[model samples]
Target: MPTITLSVKDENFAGKVLQEVLIGFHSETVTIRDIIEARVLQEVEAYNQKQPQYFNGLVQPADAEKTVNGYQLRNKVVIDPEKQVYVALDAFQKNGFFVLVDTLQCSSLNDKVRLHADTRISFIKLTPLVGG
Candidate 1:
């Protein structure tokens, strides 16, 4: 199976995830559920840490109720500073041979974060077929 690797500005966290998984952070062996969970948790933590005052009363609100770069955090998806980085498989699809390429060709999967060089992060959806 093809592997999809997620790289961040800092490699420290990347190394930690690899150590915990006992496999390449971007390997196909990782499950999609694990990847999404890690990403969600990391984002939530980062947001809360940056704005502790705002999150003091709200714990996993239905919606973040705030817009970050026009993307309203409806699901309370914030960055978690404590968990600086996360590594997991892309579970959007069931196929295990294909991989989600984080490049201009895959613009639909590319989010606004791709445009920002300051916060460089990307995720590839590994699938059974090369083209999903």
Candidate 2:
């Protein structure tokens, strides 16, 4: 089983780690969409088992006025993991976030990339300006 590390980044490169999951790939490559899906599912499972303090993914901060660190929801909101993943994916399609595979930027969701034993995948969330 190979493992991939997820890291979240803002404007700065000093990113915070989101999670790590062991994924089984049929071949030496996998699609960007599949990678995102796996990452989201892992996050959802973690949230369901033991609710984390924060969620750093492709989401609009405006959805809830109150939040922790402007990413994690402040209120104890019940989230449908599948729905959240879909929302994130949709957002990605619209340039909501960016995916970097081992320091290389991935522009297309269907793009195939080779995997490594410890691949470092980073997600950079783009925040919209207020009243812009």
Candidate of highest lDDT: 2
1-132 in candidate 1: lDDT tens per residue?
Answer: 324435422123232221111112434433434434444454455556664433321112333443332223434444432332221123233332122223322232222222221222333323211110
Candidate 1 wrong stretches, greater than 4 Å: 1-5, 8-28, 52-61, 66-132
TM-score of each: 0.31, 0.67
Q: Model 2, 80: alpha-carbon shift in Å?
A: 1.0
**Predicted structure 2: clash tally:** 0
**Alpha-carbon shift of residue 88 in model 2 (angstroms):** 1.1
RMSD of 1: 13.6
